[model samples]
Target: MALPTVPHLSQDGIAFSAVKNRPAYAIASVDSALLLASLLQQEGAMRVTDVAARLGVSVSTAHRLLGMLVYRDFAEQLPDRRYAAGPVLRRGPVQQASVARLREVALPHLRGLVEAVGETANVMVLAGPDVRFVATVESDQVLRVGDRTGRTLPAHLSSGGKAVLATLDDERLAAVVASLDAAVAVRLERELRTVRRRGVAVNDQETEAGLTAVGVAVPPSGGVTGAALSVAAPSARYSRDRLPVWKEALAEAAGGIARDLGDG
Candidate 1:
């Protein structure tokens, strides 16, 4: 059976031509990820051959794709080497067990970051093309930014989103760029390259004027989705030259959170 092609704009707000006829432009990795996700969500645990047969791909391809899913925490390797829906997916969409766990584990570190940098600290997770702010700790300073917990913003516009984006592999990145406008794709690709080189992502008032944020991706754990720890401060107080502590704090906090998730 042929999959239906649905019209949608890419992250860069560029329209994709219908995939039904022009299959050449279709991103195989993205399609495979979607197919595998659907299978795992509906069937729970599965073996390598199961995914291979369902996606009609080679066993090696299935294994490679599944590994990526595991890296992003959308799937996990079971004791027998079979794959199962990961904690993030099993917890369901929206605020639930996994998200709650992430929030609980991250809040203390976020607070510590606030104390360290005198800026607002946040934990953000990728939700499709956006980064959702699941938890935040506000700075004590009167001039600090407002609490942004529960807010959602475009992934490319925020530090956390860019950090997560930087972790995507080439095929996945190609899929994303394919959906964006020519101009936006070029710009976002350039930025992601920079993020990869630096091991961190920065938002210099990109999401909102006068606000600056620096973020680092949290390494994947058993049940954690790709996420980032970020510190947002007023640009006046966010001087990169003087705020090296913020980078150090985010790295420490991200490491702690990843460790906790691994232990669970």
Candidate 2:
């Protein structure tokens, strides 16, 4: 008997035909597993019950689907006992290697910055309109800013984001900030000019209360901006007089990474 064709949604949310000629490969269990994986990827960490609720399935079914995902390395149980997207699901094949290279080239420079500034140093890249912390080296101090590796934050609100934003051409910058309100857009346009003038960006407890940071954009020798390097500390410890020192350390680290990546 011929199976009836059914509409399916692709990863890009486009509707497509399924089940007809492909009925042999369209097992319900496999389809459910793929949907579960996609949900986990889109929603970040999710509990079994949460997944079940979202998928309109029984908890047992959600558990089984998650098990399959874990077995295939598409998802993992976080320390909090929730499931989050795993390595294979997060990056494309080429992006995985590119990110590895970025971390390798930035680690030494990040450590050096931490040692020089006595603050947490991070290597961040702009992922679309967001700033993502890819690697971090913490200062030895017991009360320093916490590690932010694998975290994403708004680009306009972070020093690293501002530093990277300063490197964009006017047209690109406008497009990236298009979602901002009129007041914020106007303010950010002015701030970018200042970042260009000072060659650094400062987040003075703007992103989070009681934290401050200094950032510098990594400029490749090829004349293109690559990433941003930043050093962060407690607001109490990050006094105005200390900005220059942190700025110098971050700039040096950024320059070193850029050079290593052939962007110096």
Which candidate tops lDDT?
1
Model 1 TM-score relative to the real fold? 0.63
Clashes of 1: 0
Best by TM-score: 2
Candidate 2 all-Cα RMSD: 16.0
Question: lDDT by residue for model 2 over 1-264, one digit each (tens)?
Answer: 221221333333322121112243478777677666655553367899988986678999999899889989999998999998777778621133345467778899998998898878888777778776677787776456655655667788789899989999878888888989899988988998999999999988676656678898887443324478888876777788888888888878877777787732
* RMSD score of candidate 1 (Å): 14.9
Q: What does candidate 1's lDDT look like per residue over 173-236, in tens digits? A: 6765676789988899899999898788998877665677899999987577768898887677
TM-scores, all candidates, are: 0.63, 0.66
lDDT of 2 at 113: 90
Each model's total of backbone clashes: 0, 4
Candidate 2 local lDDT, residue 29: 79
